[model samples]
Target: MTSPTLALDPAWITRTVAVALDEDLGPAPGRDVTTQSTIPADAVGAADLVARQDGVVAGLVVAPEVVGQVAARLGLAVPSVDQRVADGTRVARGDVLAVLTGPVQVLLVAERTLLNLASRASGVATHTRRWADALEGTGALVLDTRKTTPGLRALEKYAVRCGGGTNKRMGLYDVAMVKDNHVVAAGSVAAAIEAVRTRFPDVTIQVEADTLDQALEAVGAGARFLLLDNMPTPLLAEVVAAVRAVDPRVELEATGNLTLDRAREVASTGVDYLSVGGLTHSSPILDLALDLEPLQPV
Candidate 1:
């Protein structure tokens, strides 16, 4: 099988992992009191991160980083993590996602941190996969919104990509999105689009439209991307057709109250994307656990 490639920044992984470890173990010179009290200093063991349910795997690469940071805090030898599966790969229940070997205390200390990141990422990926599957062959892709957990945006967005969903924008900086408020402030959709285009000429501007007139006005004002907010299928199709006629290159996305049951119907309207906030905001964690086993010192 081909190795799955995950394009997460090393620094982002390191920084996020450090923060998560701090949360669990507390500030510098932190300790997992329970593990420190029970496990012997010289004791060494191994464990396998096992999947408790079938789902797409993600964040395995960050496991070793978590182990390393945990070991540093506890002054224990860092564990060697053998990743059995790559990120984005589908796995069944009971699959061994990775193996860890080191001081028993280190394993115990890092267990929750490892499972938390992996499980959450896998959950988003699994949830996104459903949308992707539903919209397959509809000439539309599932897109993730900015409605992600703060500080976890990069990781969660990466998980979205793993599950075959596209990310809309990294944040407010990359894309200038003129929502209803912006339209109200600037007087109209055209005015809002023009203001953003004038101020940030280099950045791509997307306008949110609640009506066909607004959608057309956005395109006329030079917006190549339009966000159709909460429109029913017929009206959504109308906007799509109108936008295409104006500029076939003007990409359209149908957003709000989207569900798997209606994914195909919405995509069938010829919108370029279906942006779902639930992919990150409401996905449940995929169940995973670290099963520890005693091992002889190598």
Candidate 2:
């Protein structure tokens, strides 16, 4: 069943930098003057795409053939996009998942672009999945904050969903999050909530608060959701409990410094959502590679 709260698979935000890279870097050099003068042109080679780190693979479909396009442009027969690579699975270093059979020069030229997309997108997916798994067994769900790459928001958020995370408000207009600065600029939490409510009453107004009093104040002021920012776990528990006692219907979420180790502990507080920025900003890449298999002989 789809969770009533978080939506996933908004795949319209596809990242197609692979085509861009191929367009920029011309077809692989057929005969390198330096290579031919020094080495034989008939020296063909093949290499397997090996994993260098442990991670949940993601974006392999789009990642693999990028180099192939580069190789094809360079006069090499590149592989297909359908070349199979398992995704969302854990892998160790030195595991061969793809084999590229083309001119050694083509492989060498295409190497960087292939690895660049693999590492970067995979990192985002893996981190996002961790948040999804962290809230497992609890009714809570993991959400990715808007703290994403500037132009890559759509693709990055797509990767988050691929990792099983729920994407929060995509932009400022999607949802109304009454943060500290807004509250301060408005001179009060009530004022901040009122401004958003006045303009976009139908929007989901999530107000961030530091103390139980602020949390309650936000609830009393009709915040649809409350974000408890930078509060201690114990204090978070108290605030949640207090909020429940006063207004059980108000949704609560926790943000700020939410590391993986502290995930379950905080989720145990009965907060509805946990927002993490690491999924995009600081996540390590997913390990993946694209290697071509030898074409079958007639």
Candidate 3:
């Protein structure tokens, strides 16, 4: 059976690729001098997108989209992209992920930009997979935070999903989360929850609590979800029992300073979700390279 692939917003891919291509190619007066002078415009070439290091594959579709956009900009035929592996597939070093064939110059032009998207997304997926694997068999789920690269949130979060992690909330618009600052400004957890509930009656409201008192207070304010911030495993377990006693339905999420080493222990505390910021912000780029095959006469 074939693995399912991710679907991205076509318009977002187009806009992002256009900006990336423009940045690399510069303005019309400036050109890729080396390719322009050496490679003939009609010269056809093929290249393989190879993995320099093992990682989970993500954003395979985006690479082709970027190639097609660059081809249109340069008036070259869009390259044929044959993706050998689906997103979420684990690959080893030297694995050929995809094949690209078209004008050599166009291929060179799109090379770096396409690799940037794929490598970055794959990096996030690879890191997230570790967390998912760590929490395997635990009832808790690995979740991604909003701390993602600007203009790449959707793609990054999608990569997390591909890595077996769940997305907590897309943005501030999707969920109402009252944190410590909001509680301070509102004078209490209940007050903050009340204000958000009064303003956005239909949204899911989650309150952040630093202590057991605040957690109980949040539950009293009709918050069905609570974010237990920075608590140790023992305290987290205690809070879980307390909250469950008050209202068994109140969902709890543990956040702050969550490291992969402690993921299983934290999940054992009975929290429903473990939100990790490092999944996107701190993941190293997966090493990938585009190796051009020798040119042949058409």
Candidate 4:
């Protein structure tokens, strides 16, 4: 399996793993009470991170780091995790994504945290893959919105990319998105575009248009990127034609109420992108489990 095209920052992964471990095990004197009481300190064994349901695999690379951090906090030997498949690979229910070996206590301590991160990431990827598949053969691309979990934006966005979906904007800092509120505050689409242009000349400005008139006004104000919010198929087609007539280079995105069943119909409207907020916010966690092999007598 080939690696994903997008790169995840090593420092970010390490920090995220550290923070997650801290949350689960607590700070400094953190301990897994059950494991500490039941398992012998020197008892060592192996376990497999197995999929309980068929889905795309993700977040395997971060598993080892989680194990190390949890073990370090517990004063135990860090477990080794070997990824069996690359992220984004289509996996079956029984597939092993990674193998871990270390003190039984350490393995048990890291299991839930590892499964939580990987399962959540894989769920987003799986949901996004369906969108990508539905939009196949259409020139339009699938994009994800800012409706991600509060702290898992980076991991969730990375999963989206792995599943062949594009990121619209990382945050408000990267691109200027003049939504309905922004337009209302600025008086009009033209005024909003002008204000954003004056403040951040180099940033790409995307204006939201609810009707043909607003669409045309945005284009008239030199905005080339437009988000066609919640417009029906026929109205979207009209807006597409109207914008194309003004400038063929303008990029149009269709968003709001975009579902998997409506992907083709929306894409057929000639919009350049279809943005889905559910990719991150409402995706269910992919089922995953860790099964430990019995430790042999030393």
Candidate 5:
């Protein structure tokens, strides 16, 4: 069953799965030569996608798409992908997340691609969950940055959501973030804000401020959101208090050099969010493997 919370678009999944299949099986008419050589044309098999380590599951919804795409490329009937666990479900080691039944060749062809997506996504979710768990009850939400896999931003950001973290900005088009470079280019924080507002007035603007003066200047210049980059806990608390006094509605996010051990202390500073780039960049893949049972003669 699909997890209602995971809003993975069907078209995105199809396109991504197709690209992944091409990467593995090569161009059209290209195939898994090993499977073709060893497996009988009509042989069938069953397999389980088992977790080798505990983690929050993700990307199960994309499994069927992967199977179908691989079958299409291999000129075989589409496989039956029975997903046993929904995305976002916490899974223990040895848990069976899905069962696959189809042509032996199709199963083999889709195995690696499916496992790649599931493992990466689950890893991100697991890492984000740790941050989320750390800041629980602190009235602060964990946020993810653009530090995502080049072609898998949607998948990674969705995994962050599954782990109870909020997505900061999907891309540069969606949000106008004035960082140190943007500030330098425009001459001042206010100038950058004015330029972005004049060009893309509807886009949400977030200003990255390294000092308390810059933070206050950003708010006075009408920046409703601020990324408090790399500030110490005491200074961050002071900035938060100062901003709140000036404009209580201005949102604040603490970012950079953050560790799980200091998550609560940072969140306790009354910032609205904490941005972590490591959610997608540094997370290790959640161990998973496809255990294919012996092929059965058709």
Candidate 6:
């Protein structure tokens, strides 16, 4: 197994650990009495951070953040993630992402939380990579949707990028994506585009269309990209051909029920993007573990 590529956000690393500490011991005493009693104060320990499952790594940058926060909370200061592993790299069973050294009490307390972040982040990276790999030669970029963790949008999206995937709108403001409800509420795709365009002239307008005619309506309203929502492959090809025929400059994006097995065929239609909700909603997580070595008296 290759080494882990740690590219986690430093801010998140600190914040995550800080919050964990606050939740567990913001007002409580330091030095978990139970741990202190069981383990001698002079005992030193070492652990080999290893993975139990195969997956790409993301948010590895924050590993040290966890270690540091936990160490500090326990009144021990170990080096913060001394060396980082690369983000967006693959890891196999028994790979060492980083080396953490500190008091045994601190290490034991921080174990579950540390592994949790590493595993989940790497899972997202791995899941996104699979889809990106599936459409490797199709020239279509795999895109992520709004389906994301509540507070980890930045991290999750970072993972997707690490996996060779492109991001759609990071949030509501990054770009305007008008979907089925928006189009209907506005009374028409053209109306939604016109309204948004009238308000934000510089922003790219992407209106979702359920059918070819609706797609045409979106294009006519000066939409730069048309999202073909839930269209079958045959209809997708027809829509792509129609959009190009009407105005070759318009970009077409596909969304809705696109899976790894079917994405290649969809991308072959010359669509510019394909959005997958599963990257966040359904992707499996990577498995990682931390191993400890008995500290010789020093």
Q: Which candidate wins on TM-score?
A: 5
Candidate 3 lDDT over residue span 1-298, tens digit each: 0112446778888888877877888853236778888999899989999999998988887988877877777787888998899888899999999999888888898888889999999999999999999999999888888899998987898899888888888899979999988878999888888888789998899889989998998899898999999999999999999999999999999999899899999999899989999999999989999999998766
Model 2, 247: alpha-carbon shift in Å? 2.4
List candidate 4 stretches off by more than 4 Å: 1-4
After best superposition, candidate 4 residue 101: deviation in angstroms? Answer: 1.2
- The digit string of per-residue lDDT tens for model 5 on 118-221 reads 99999999999999999999999889989999989989988988888888888878899999999999999999999999999888999999999999999999
How big is the positional error of residue 196 in model 4, measured in Å on the Cα after superposition?
1.1
| Per-residue C-alpha lDDT of model 6 across residues 1-298, encoded as one tens digit per residue | 0112334457766766666556655543344557767876555577777778878987667766666666666667564354446778788877787777767777776777777766777888899999888898888888888899887776777788888888788688768888878877988777888888889987777788889898887778777788898989999999999999989998888999888889889999889889999898777778888787777766
Candidate 3 overall lDDT versus native: 0.88
The lDDT values for all models are 0.89, 0.70, 0.88, 0.88, 0.90, 0.77
The residue-level lDDT of candidate 4 at 35 comes to 86
Q: How does each model score on TM-score?
A: 0.96, 0.75, 0.95, 0.96, 0.97, 0.90
**For model 3, the run of ten residues with the poorest summed lDDT:** 1-10
lDDT of 4 by residue, 1-298 (tens): 1133766777888888877877887885587788899989999999999999998877777887888887778788888888899998999999988889998988998888888889999999999999999999999988888899887898998898878888888887889999999988989888888898899998999988999999999999999899999999999999999899999999999999888889999999899899999999999989999999977978
Question: What digit string (tens of lDDT, one per residue) describes model 2 on residues 1-298?
Answer: 1232333233322235444453445432333345336433344567677777776666555544555555555565663333336655666776765666656655665666667656776688778777788779988888888788775666567667767777788898878888888988999999988888788877778888999889889988887688899888999999999999998998888999888889899999999988888888888766656454453433
So what's the TM-score on candidate 1?
A: 0.96
Worst 10 residues of 2 by lDDT: 1-10
Worst 10 residues of 4 by lDDT: 1-10
Which residue pairs clash within candidate 6?
Answer: 5-85, 5-86, 5-87, 6-85, 6-86, 8-61
Which residues of candidate 6, in runs, are more than 4 Å off?
1-9, 23-34, 80-84
User: Total backbone clashes of model 2?
Assistant: 11
Distance from true location, Cα of 187 in model 6, Å: 2.2
Q: Rank the candidates by TM-score, best first.
A: 5, 4, 1, 3, 6, 2
TM-score of 6: 0.90
Better of 4 and 5 by TM-score: 5
**Candidate 3 colliding pairs:** none
